[model samples]
Target chain A: MPQPDVVDDESVAAVEAGLDALDTPTERRRRFTWRRAAAVVAPPVLAIVLLIAVWQALWAAAFWPEYQLPAPAAVWQVITDNVQTGVAFDVLWNSVHRAVLGFAAGVLIGTPLGLIVAKVRIVRAAIGPLLSGLQSLPSVAWVPAAVLWFGVTPSTVYFVVLMGSVPSIANGLVAGIDQIPPILPRVGTVLGASRLGSARHILLPAALPGYLAGLKQGWAFSWRSLMAAEIIAVSPQLGKGLGAFLEEGRNLSDMPTVIAAIFLILLVGIGIELLVFRPLERSVLRARGLSGAF
Target chain B: MTATLETSAMTTAVRLTGVHKSFGAGRGAVSALEGVDLSVAPGEFVCLLGASGCGKTTLLNLVAGLDRPTAGDIALSTSRPAVMFQEAALMPWLTASRNVELALRFAGVRRTQRRERAGELLELVRLGGLGDKRPHELSGGMRQRVALARALASAVQGSQDGSPALLLMDEPFSALDAITRDVLQGELLRVWRSTNTAVLFVTHDVREAVRLGQRVVLLSSRPGRVVREWQVGDLEPSAEAAAIEEINTSLREVISSHAAA
Candidate 1:
């Protein structure tokens, strides 16, 4: 609160008046103009187009043997061939179902666990290191243990995905809660927001950016864990997933099918991130004027 | 016209006796408020002016019941005093209207009535059409206006007879540009006239304190003892603007001497 040295009264008054007059009036618009929308979406779309063109050129140039790196057309043929037979849809659905279920479980378990660890010093001290350490351990590493625990069933895949994703989601929540501005909690208390009310209105909303980040990571972990479980702990009764398709491609030496499976997995992961979590993150950060950081 | 005299006879709006607040413990202990005594009558505007570390904010907190006074008693005849911080403190997720609606909601206003009440409060602060806009969408002045509207909305819903709901402002207008601050001070006086909510404003601006408060209370730095009090009746808005200016100049001299020492 250091005050600047006083200048001539008239000059200071003029400058203050100018600053007052310069305050910008905010505009209200219901819908994004096409130009504005295009401004935002154009770059990513252009990058994707550039990428596909490069991929196609590499295939045409015969950069690698067909048995190693299949052509785009060859991968497309594998997709069309399996899709017509309905097996592609079944595998996609199976993987998506497992990922969704695992993500839900992780969120449910992790949110409360995060709140406890964040609010209580003793609980955080006891489990904080372990939670971070668990995040570092790859989801794929859990497949063997999950197979032993659940005996090569669908339950094993579910367990593996949950184990992989839960720590990240919980840790995200804790980080989000921790990062909440100290001013907000004080404001809530003064406004008569009780402990539970503060958690609901102030703590939860403030932590949302971090929590959403965790959710994005949780989904990735779930997808990775399911794929690992399907490939390593395969059971016909558990049905086919993208990992199973990749495994089948390896057995048959069909590089095109393997490439198609890999592409599908990559596409889905990116799609979920863009369509779901990205918007959520953008909205939260934008509300807080932190979108500039992005 | 004598609303202050009328209301003072009714009941004490806020009474804080021997209030003490300290942070940390043992060797690291830092006292924020030490044996402070204050009583704000209904409809009175009291400004607490001091340098940094003067515990102005700590005193405000004690009255708001946000934190307990370590050694003293605080009694509010009405519900808890509504607080306005230096920052707007509006919820970013909510629109300006919904921010006001939250206060109404907590005060037990019916859901159907909240929208109209929120709109009315917005108009009270000259932000009539900006209710749908989020905090980010508003300028700093507009955001603080919304915050003032929200605080007023709470007082309206919560205040009881005799003891008007107290509005504890912790340098709410300090961050604003001078014109906006001037406009808001005018708006606050108008609002105070209508609602009769006793205001306990904290500021380091001596002119601002003289302009806004019926009585200005000066606090010493650190443990924050009440050092002096000035009755600023002739400087009230009802007085001639020239007389108020002269009062402001003298108040600035007092503050400058304090700074020099």
Candidate 2:
């Protein structure tokens, strides 16, 4: 058929404009008010308060000896002293630096490993099961072996951290690649995207959620392995970390110091999650219109 | 007539001769398309009408170069033929404009020009000012329009002789509501007419085929072959209705005959 006349074009555009006006959803931007902030923030704050209250009550009730399960104030005092002396910063810096370096290395290595395994049939057949197995194995289990190989040095901690994270990161990528709808790659092929172009533009982006989830898990593993390595491989060269601090508290039989160290560990874990992964996940999911509460 | 024929041959968008495609080998082998011969002229609007299991999609894949034909020759004037799937297939991570831009990027458009070109394509699809919206943000019909824009972006500057490229659409509007489908059909017609791109639209909807196609080819089921063809050029409304009814009757006969056999 010939092209529509000018009048037809005008009317068609009018009709389309009308259809679009009706069909397009109105965006009601939910303003983040103080009330909304409180709604989100109050629960966690209240939970911590409630826990502290319970701990105080337990202390008052004398459920355990003061030396065995130190008072909240004693633990608080220990934390304050560490902060005041700048020891807390040193401990956190040591642990965080190792965790970041190890995780970064894990990402660099795991990404290509995952890509190779995901794309190459022979590599997948050879190592797919092994990757899954490694993800399940506790990184702490590698601590003794890592110590034996690298000695009681920073390398031992890093070796343990890598072992903990690499499998999770690589496996996460593989899972992400696997979950991609078959039609997506076909669409890429039809669009005439070269293999590398498709990987960059299509495959990696499609697998982002899975890969992010893997990174989060990998971080958790890295932290855990670092702690395990530090606790076991106690050396003067490896400056005191949170795990070493906790071990020191144990050796000194100081309940307050031990509790303070444990609290710092928990605080760091939650802080990293909130500061890094949660926002990353939220943005990624929101962009994809999958931001509904899970 | 001889001169016109020569021109047609030179300007052919795609041609498939004795094209055969099968799924597997040995006892498990299932043929999808067998000895299929077809040709699409430049700037033609052709619809392939067939029931489920007729290998309409397989034929499109073969032509799009996503898959090779098991046997026989499939030739295209352009190496990169744009394709739109049933689903919009817009990258979830990309906004509507970015999705279109990605296509332009692949089509070898310079980075500096991609954003502007993507915007123009979006405007061509009547999706102007909604380029920043992601696929999930847009309504189903709107997403399909974005997909249409992306397809158009991929087609731009595709033909070496500066002619329009081919677009293979596989039931792109089948997933939409009737009202949305109607709107999109009109939009598609407008786009096709303006761009002068050859489109081989595959669908089972006879009404849609008659509504949009300059020519409609019917395919037989289970190892699909072209069973019939209809040229719907320059028909009046009443005559178009009559043509639709005739095609529907023939389609029913084809389906029933297959059942009986």
Winning candidate number (lDDT): 2
Q: How well is each residue in A1-294 modelled by candidate 2, as lDDT tens digits? A: 323232367777887787777878666668889999999999999999999999999999998999897889999999999999999999999888888999999999989999899999999999999999999998889888877888888888888999999999999999999999998898888777899999999999999999999999999999988888888889999999989999999999999999999999999899999999999999999889888752
Q: DockQ for every model, please.
A: 0.24, 0.49
What is the C-alpha lDDT profile of model 2 across B86-113, one tens digit per residue?
Answer: 9998899999999999987776779879
Write the residue-wise lDDT of candidate 1 on A1-294 in tens digits.
222233344444454345434664544444868998898899989998898789789888998887987777888899999889999899999899888988899899989998999999999999999999999999788888777787989888888898888999999999999988788888777666778888987899989988988988989998888888888977788888999989999999999999899988998899899899888888788777666765
Q: How does each model score on lDDT?
A: 0.81, 0.88
Best by TM-score: 2
What CAPRI-style quality would you assign to candidate 2? acceptable
Position A245, candidate 2: lDDT = 95
Q: Give residue B97's lDDT in candidate 2 (0 to 100).
A: 92
Per-residue CA lDDT of candidate 1, range B61-154, in tens? 7777666666877767666678899999898888999889888776667988999999998977777877888887777887888899888877
TM-score of each: 0.86, 0.95
